[model samples]
Target: MATFVIVGAGLAGAKAAQTLREEGFDGEVVLIGAEEERPYERPPLSKGYLQGRSEREKIFVHPPYWYADQEIDLRLGVTVTGIALDAHEVALDDGSRMSYDKLLITTGASPRTLPGQAYTLRTVADSEALKAGFAAGGRVVIIGAGWIGLESAAAAREAGCEVTVVEPAPTPLHRVLGPELGEVFAHVHRRHGVDLRLGVSAEEVEADGVRLGTGERLPADLVVAGVGAAPNVNLAREAGLEVGDGILTDAALRTSHPDVYAAGDVAESYHPLYGRRLRVEHWANALNGGPAAARSMLGQEVVYDRVPYFYTDQFDLGMEFSGDTRGYDQVVIRGEELEFIAYWLREGRVIAGMNVNVWDVVDDIQRLIRSGGPLPPQD
Candidate 1:
């Protein structure tokens, strides 16, 4: 019997297993995870789950019984010690070998550790620890003002904790949103009573607080580091797979090895739309990439060219961004920060857009990006 083995039962892996069955592939499906708990949604771990608006079990991707009900051979708390590509087998840490006709690696990414009392937001346990740290409304000095850092700051402030956000850039998310739009977000945090510190990094992370490069030492009860994450590509690198920033994959999410594939944060798959390789570590990518790769495994020709999209919720601000914002020559704002639509124009063509507190226009935003049409003249 042909067996399809998927390592790392994160959102991507779990969805791929489900997709395999949905696509009429009746072969054996094995899903493995290093974490003992069942696969769960990660976005809520920092937002709703951390804010007490959601339950721990509510964030799971599927019910505990769903795996068995779907006839998936789910292996929790199992580690893949090695992969024998020639033999088409994966050696487990428990000294067991699983044969595979096709394999998918969705190992995902881990948070980049800084030399500080930092906490990451990738897992349920991590969220719980963050919440416990803010239990007494303690002073929180969080490094990195990216999505994770800002979101954690929001949750911390909601829990009545004093939060001081430190970022090296002039504004938050400067690399992604650029300075103008980034200023919009900076104001949001400042309006919410968060101590916004910009253009400086931590000189030292001590038990009491973080010493800044600007000769200021902020007292902190809990120092959370919401720095960015690096793709977990060590396994693929060790297996001699082609890796650049992340596991290199073709348009169909197939790795260099013929029988092995990669997806999610770990897979820097080719994007036909952008004509470049991208590794998007967002919920939407994992939600869509899994099924796309599953179809490819079943010998279906696919491009896997969905426009990159992601959303973030901080306090009252809800925003959805589409397309890549790099190298845009023009940026037009339709309204002010609170409720507005920002467009990134590359030579008059609308290449990227973000709608803040504007409801139900993501489809329209995507259409604009796909059309590559010039934005209409605005005063």
Candidate 2:
């Protein structure tokens, strides 16, 4: 039997193992993880789970016994020290070696750290630590207006804590959503008793609060820095694999080495839809990319093409989006700003669409984007 070794047992790695079994590979599968816990989905880590509205069991991608039942060797709390392609083996931290006919890397990404009294959320342990701070209704001063920061702000407020979000940008999500739509989020957070401070950053994270760049100090019992994440590409880079921003892979998810494959947040896969390469770090990408990488590993002719999809829920807003926002010439807004759909158009063709507080339109929006034709003018 062909032995397949999978590094990093996140959602992508777990799903890939499941796919291998379902596809009747009948191979000896090994799943390894640095984290001691079972593979779990991360979206809830910053949302439901952190908000005390979700249980730990609900976060797991698969129950504990599922791996044993599937006849897969699941190794938890282990680290891969080195990958030896010439020998078709991996050196482990435990001084053991694992050989594989095929190897998959789903190492994922790590949260960017700040040099201060600040916390970042990445693993369940991180969430648990933050949850303890929220239990006391502590004052939270979050640095960064990105998705993680905004979501953490909303969750902290939900926990009866005083929340203040400080961003260097003019508005929340300004870089991704642009200033106009970013203001919408700014208004929502401010309306919900959140002190949304724009165009400022913490000069230093003090013991009791944050000192702003403009010489203002905000009291904070808990400090969170959700600046961003960096792809865990050191392993691939060390192995002499092509890496740029992330581990470089083709549309089918194959890496520079034929026997080596990558998926999820760490894999910079070529997107046929955009005719370029992008490394997407979202729940949808991990959930879908896992199986795609598996199919390609099985020597099946495949092109991993799927419309990028992501959603977020904060306060009373629930939004979903499809397509890429690159090279868009115009943004068309339909309905009111708060409860509306925004379409990014390039040369009269829809390139991306986002809906906020709107339901049952993602399918149609995706169709229009894929159609790459003119959309009806907003009434």
Candidate 3:
């Protein structure tokens, strides 16, 4: 039987292995992970799990016994040290090597850190620590007003902690939602009693608090740095694969090497619809990309052109975003005050849409984006 070796057993890797078996691959499937825990979904870590709304068992991609019953070799607590592309083998940190007829790399990203002991939410343990700190209900100073920062702020506030969010941008999600819609998020957090210090930087992360660029110090009991995350591409880079913002892959999710494939946060794969390379780091990508890569590995024709999708639940506001924001010059807001459908248009063509406090419209939003047409006039 042909052996398929999968590295970095996150949601993508776990799902890929599951897909292989479901597709009748009957091959020697080995899923390896550096983390001791079995593959689990990460969205809960920053959302429900962190907020104590979700139980720990809900995060796992599969039940603990699923792997053994599926007849898959699941290797936990071991890291893939290196890959010998010429030999089609991967060396493990445990001083063992495994050969594969096909290989899939699903190594995810790591949370960017600050100099001090500021916390970042990426793994289950990280969320557990943050949850405990928030439960204590003291003061929380989060640097960076991105999704993670804002979400954590909401959780902290719900836990009765004094929360302060510092952002260098003019609004919370300026880079993603742009300034206009970004202000809406800022308004929500501010209204919920979050201290939003916009247009400033966290100069220093001290033990007691954070020092602002304008020479202001905010005392805090816990500090969180949600700056961003960088894809773990060192393994792919060292293995002489094409690497840029992430590992370069074709529309079929095949890497530079024929036998190697990449997906999830680490694959900057070509989008047939967008006509460009896109590296999406959202949970939806891992949930879908893994199976796509698995199908492609099985020599099936695949075009991984699914529209990017992600959602957030914070405070009383729940939101879902679909499509890409690239080249969108105009945003049409159909409603206001958290009950709205915001459409991003580029030269009168819809490119992306976000629905806030709205439900069951993602499919329609994605359809409109794929249509690449003007927003339909309401009757």
Candidate 4:
């Protein structure tokens, strides 16, 4: 039996191993991760799980028993230090080497760090520590107003902590939802008693507080940083794979080497629909990309063209966004305030849609984007 090895045992890697078995591949499967914990999803690390609304076990992709039952060699707390593409082997930190007939890299990404002392949420431990800080219910100074920062602010506020968010942008999520919708988010946070200091940079982060570019110092009991994340592409780059913003792959998820494949946030795969390569670092991407790559690895025809999707919950607001919003010229609002659907259009074609406090229209939104149709007025 051929041995299939998966590196970085995240949600994508675990799902890939499961897919290999489900597709009737009677091969030796190995899942290796640098984290001692089993495969788990990351969303909860900043959402429900961080808010103390979700149990620890719920964050796991699979129970511990599942791996044993599936006869997979799940190696945790082990790092793949190097990948020797020519030899078809990976060098582990423990001084062990493993050979593979086929290899999949799902190494994922790491949270970007700030210049000084601050916490970031990327793993379970990170969440737990943040959760404890929130539970302490003191003052919190968040260094970004992006998704993670805003969500952490909400959690901190819920825990009765005095919260303040500092962002260099004119409004929260300015680059993402743009100015119009970004203002809406700003309104919500401000309404919920958050001190949102917009258009100012966090010049310095100390253990006690944050200093702004405006020369104002905001004291804090705890600091949380949510700048963004960068894909873990060192292994692929060192192995001589074609890497750009991430490991470059085709629509089939095949990397520069035929015997090696990539998926999830680490893989910048060609998107047939958008006519460009995209690296979507969202739960939906990993949830679906893994299985797609597995099928492709089994010599099945595959085109990974799923629409980008993500959801967020903060305070009493819940929102879902779908499709690509890049290069949109217009944003159309269908409803009013919090319970509305917003559409991003290029010329006359719908490119993306977001429903805030609205219900059950993601399918319609995605269909409209895929159709690239002109908005039919009067509905």
The true-versus-predicted C-alpha distance at residue 230 of model 1, in Å, is 0.6
Better of 3 and 4 by lDDT: 3
Worst 10 residues of 3 by lDDT: 370-379
Write the residue-wise lDDT of candidate 1 on 10-124 in tens digits: 9999999999998888889999999998988899988898899987888988999999989999999999988888889999999999899999999999998878567778888
TM-scores, one per candidate: 0.98, 0.97, 0.98, 0.98
Give lDDT for model 2: 0.91
* lDDT of model number 4: 0.93
Task: For residues 53-151, write the lDDT of model 2, one tens digit per residue.
Answer: 899899999988999999999999999999998899999999999999999999999999888789999999998888888888978999999999999
Give the Å shift of residue 62 in candidate 4: 0.8
Q: RMSD, model 4, all Cα superposed?
A: 1.0
- Candidate 2 vs candidate 4: the TM-score winner is 4
The candidates, ranked best first by lDDT, are: 3, 4, 2, 1
**Cα error, candidate 2, residue 356 (Å):** 1.0
User: Could you tally the backbone clashes for each prediction?
Assistant: 0, 0, 0, 0
Q: Which stretches of candidate 3 lie over 4 Å from their true place?
A: 374-379
1-379 per-residue lDDT for model 4 (tens digits): 8999999899999999999999999889999999999999999988999888899999999998999999999999999999999999999998989999999999999999998889988999999999999999889999899999999999999899999999999999998889999999899999999999999999999779999999999999999999999999999999999999999999999999999999999999999989999999999999999999999999999999999999999887899999888898988898887899999988788888999999888998899989966875334
> Where does candidate 4 have its weakest 10-residue lDDT segment?
370-379
Residues 221-258, candidate 3, lDDT per residue (tens digit)? 99999999999999999999999999999999999999
**CA-lDDT, candidates in order:** 0.91, 0.91, 0.94, 0.93
How high is the lDDT of residue 160 in model 4?
Answer: 91
Error of 2 at 176 (Å): 1.4
